[model samples]
Target: MKFFNRLLIDFAYYLQNSVAYQQKRRFFYNLLENDEYKYKKYFDICMIILIFSSVSILIYEVKKDVHDYLNIFNSYVISFIFLIEYLLRLWVASSVSKVIINQDEYSDLLGREFDLWFVTKKILKEKFEYILSPKAIIDLLAIMPFFHELRLLRIFILFRVFKLFRYAKSFQTFSSVLATKKFEFVTLGMFASIVIFVSSVLIYVMEANDPNSPIKTLYEAFYWSIVTISTVGYGDVVAVSKEGQFVAVVVILAGIAVLAFTTSLFVSAFTEKLDDIKESKTIQDISKNKRVYLICGYENIAKEVAKKLLLAKFHVVVIDDSLQRVEDAKKDGLTALNYNPGSIESYAKLNIDMSVQVKAILCLREDDVANVYTALTVRSINTDVFIMSLLMNSKNRNKLIYSGVNEILYDKEFVGLVAREYVGQPVAFEAIHTLRSETSAIHMEEIAITERILAKYPTVEKLENIKYRIVLLGVHKKSSSKFFFNPSDDTELETGDFLLVIGNYMFIREFNKHLSHKGEV
Candidate 1:
């Protein structure tokens, strides 16, 4: 029954390879199929089967006679399968357009001008270069015509299975980790190469002349060198003479030291890279359709500020000199633009748009001087733009305010305020901060009563007593900073009348109904 099922599947795949089926395939055909999970399931199953089969073959190779027979069978069978698979892949390459339209595929490969034979020839010729890459070459070599002579080359077939490891979760993540730490890895690789080469040469010199020695050529020395350094000590090869023994001690000690050092290098590299990846992930999340909130430094307060900005739907763009903090920001899905925020060029390069409806710049650089400088540069660009700067020292607060920062957040004042509130305060410290935060998404906007609408409506405050949730907090008479707190219901609302309402965002939105109705009136 399983055999029948496998045969049916193969037949379906063959039938699906037809040109008629190809033309009707849409771009994103794979996506449209709605069987992504099914495809992945089948792919996973194939991977498991392939891995087990390879492992079984490797185990069988330990027995000489069975190894020879199995190797011969695999050499021919795999090569033939690869040949057919290669041909089939070329045939169905056109179907990728059903996945997504590539113009080159339409005009160049499978154009109306090309016949079946021509298309096949063209694809093979075009992909011939890619087919010659190290991996592909090994794959093709595993399946070549001289099957029996290349029994050992069946081992190269294992490379194709190794390719499957790339698709695995662990290997994929490892690859990304390597990519992130490519430079460090490259340096470590160079160090390892030097150690390996030096060890191999020394081992060959020390062991080559010994009668009982297995290390004959430089190649044999390389194998021994790898075993020693990795502490694998396979025991298949060893040195025997007194001088060789002395050399062995030195080599083994060197190997141990080198092994520890290399391990440390990789550990450090991966640690740094992982942190970077985390920070980048955090920045990406923060930047998604959100307003920018530039954090000047990686202070503890900056962390709290970032949380607040995130709550208000703002993408926090941080500029900090500390690479570690930048990585931390990335981990939090915040844009840690790694630079000293003190420089004018840094702000300019970051594209500080004064005119755009941005929330505000929160300056909290580690250095008081840097924060003040950053604030000054920002204020110079756009005097109308809001700047919320934290002054580390109370002395800088007056300077920052005079320098044209809209709001100066004094840590001392904040701490004192919190203490005062703990004793007994009118409002919560957090609530006061929320209302004072110019960058908050929830803002109290004052809309003036225009005359055209007032001609029809005698009073705007009359609607306040309707028992709805929207409260009339205050009324500001025209051109006066003085606002009437909790204005009367019958107060005649004239032109240029400013009404202050207090509620959460939904009520504020609902509060706009009065303006819209007035416009219609």
Candidate 2:
């Protein structure tokens, strides 16, 4: 018992510490539950196909006999797959080993004996909670048709259709909308029930004595009431008496009012959720890319930057709290989200930490406070992601830096400096401005010296020889974090160094392609 206990503890510790194990677990978790996972859509598609096929087979069997092979495949094969899905879901729902390890660590900290029974109970409690969850219950029921020996349990084969709710995000969204209006729905339900009950009672009382009336019993009257309220008058049941006809008219009017109310409620719920659904789709689309520029504000500067990034073939996602700004970004043909940049929940919703695709975060909110908060929130979620923010006020520069802003732009100060420079060198300033602006075909671009580039061109002279049209203005060294202006030909190029080059946009593109293909330009 002692040996077995020790082995179990060691196993739990291994599970908690093992990188490979944790990675595998995380992959499974993402595959099963993470909507932003790259392969989740494919997984969902496959599951949907299986569900439809299984349900189709079940429905087919209802009217006619199925082949023994088809029956076996549906009953055993699909059920087996569902059984595995259920177990995997259960496994990912909560970590039993994590709970065990936490308990063991707590026991050690308190200098007490490890309580196996306590850990067992806690694990059981978590598993039980998961098992009782609506999705999990559906999963369990979906697998019940495997036990075909029990003829009564065969009806559960239909529950496989409900499994679509798990894979279809739209269904979940609809369910969420309905969940939010629970109180209103409950009130509507109560009112509807009262109307139905009263209508049924009145119809039964008025029609029971009338020999010509089709509703002879309370059950029949209840059925008639449902049919009438639903506006599906089968014409099989008729109220011959005037009193019965009056009740029917009243019930029909109430049904129309109830339906109108229900329609209004659904319309309002969906209207409210429309933005959220769009945002979710935008996030999913952003997640599909392996690299994306995250712009926190959809202001003028941010919009221009996003456009430039998009033109450069880089994915860009604009996020702002202002709905108008988000809408403007959408209008401008950009992926945008209406989300609070300062809120940690927004970062989590974007899956920033989980996604290595976020190449950089640009906080360009006009408000200094909002920029600082956004910087802080992003830094907390992702430490290594490059962050740049616009410094509206000079005084907040230190605060922005402390909040983990890698670069800070001062619009006023920059403009002032440019104005001063323009006074001294009007022609030079204008030429530079023209080159930077959209009107000019010439553009400035940075080319990073990757391992391939470093191997091919070890010196500045070698790189310059590769392309004559492109001018190597300066080299930004990653090591010293400084730019070497007009470096000598003998200057050594290294990995992580960026070549600041100026050329026509087409020339730059050709130069990059030359570097990539390792061929003569």
Candidate 3:
């Protein structure tokens, strides 16, 4: 049965590809599908503006003498756009479903195919499924204005305005927060219900027998109880007797307590959920980032490195396999995500494209295979970006080097070095001084030399005539096996060389800026 099932699936996929779709499937897919395609934002913004205008028109038409000859024409225009959007969305669904079923888009290597009925049935099935989806239902509702003329029906059509919430990330976060804390919401609701029932029964028994009582029946007493508890005691219902008034006071106090507790719960949930939304958006916004650090582990060493980078006021994103560690990183005010670091989807989930400004990636996993795999993946995605891998075993060093890792830090060597430095262990506190300060006289910076800077400062010897108060420590080049440590004054400075310099931080900044802006350094 499994074999036959696979056969049928393959046949259907092949058949779907044979059909001639009328519109540009890829074009409509990017424009209307759920994924954030290139043009999707602009398309969504335009649709939202159109929806708001339509809703405003509906509200205006509700007033007396507001209807004009253009009103009917305006309704037609809005309905037409909604209809186009709905149809386009359906087409997008069909295209996506077809593409999903057929990953390779196999050509006629073999001259066999399924019948037309098979393909039609599969395509129509997908369309039917999409029509029942929540977004599709919203799209359809946006077009109901043309189907009816009744004022009451207009209210339902007016709800089309709510479709705007699909684009509102904060509102979506609030809904998700509510879902996550549904137990708390239910508990609060049950508690309020119990209070309402007890208060209603008490007030009814106390005031129902009185002929002049405003709360004359059980139903009226229930209404009065609710109003009193909510602090909205409408004059239509009230407690006339002193005994009834005492019960009213108790209900008001309970209501205040319940409402305050509920408000606090909601506020806490909102804050947490809002932070989650902001973190996700921050990842998305990094596509425009000119330089960012992508740290690929959440271990102690990775954490320390990330802290140093962040202290230098650099943007850093950490990816790890453990969800708990990712959350911990986020709680520590660090940007982190959970992903299978070896997967292509993980790279895509970095929320960056090839053009993104990626300064470097840190592969600090203890697993040599995982580190090498990540190095290869990052290298495939970006050829120029630096990849620094931590060697778990000496034997894997050559493997990582072959994987295009720009640098390797051997763990054993570092551990040995740390062991030797045990005498000055308290010197760890000196790192705090590295944090930039406005009053600090000296700061270290790695300034990259470009072709323009190389034209003037052709060699280290030429830099001595400069009046800028700075000291050159060393130059690191990707093409070299080791850094050129305090090279001779005549050593040539290449275009891609990185300069290690110490000076007044502001002066260093201005000097690098000048190098970047001109033909001469």
Q: Write the per-residue lDDT of candidate 2 for residues 257-367, one digit (tens) a residue.
A: 888888888988889888777777777777677888889998888888888888878888888999999999999899888889888898778765434788889999888
Candidate 3 global TM-score: 0.59
Candidate 2 segments whose C-alpha is farther than 4 A from its true place: 1-28, 36-40, 59-67, 91-128, 148-155, 201-205, 208-212, 216-219, 272-350, 354-357, 363-383, 391-404, 416-429, 444-521
Distance from true location, Cα of 13 in model 1, Å: 69
What's the TM-score of every candidate structure? 0.39, 0.75, 0.59
In angstroms, the error of model 1 at 21 is 54
Ranked candidates (TM-score, high to low)? 2, 3, 1
- How should the candidates be ordered by lDDT, best one leading? 2, 3, 1
lDDT of 1 by residue, 318-366 (tens): 8887889878886776767677766767666554455463568788765
lDDT of 2: 0.88
lDDT of each: 0.64, 0.88, 0.76
**Model 3 segments beyond 4 Å from truth?**
1-23, 60-74, 95-125, 146-157, 173-291, 296-300, 320-328, 337-359, 365-386, 391-406, 411-503, 516-521
Model 1 / residue 259 / CA error / Å: 30
- Superior by lDDT: candidate 1 or candidate 3: 3
Model 1 TM-score relative to the real fold: 0.39
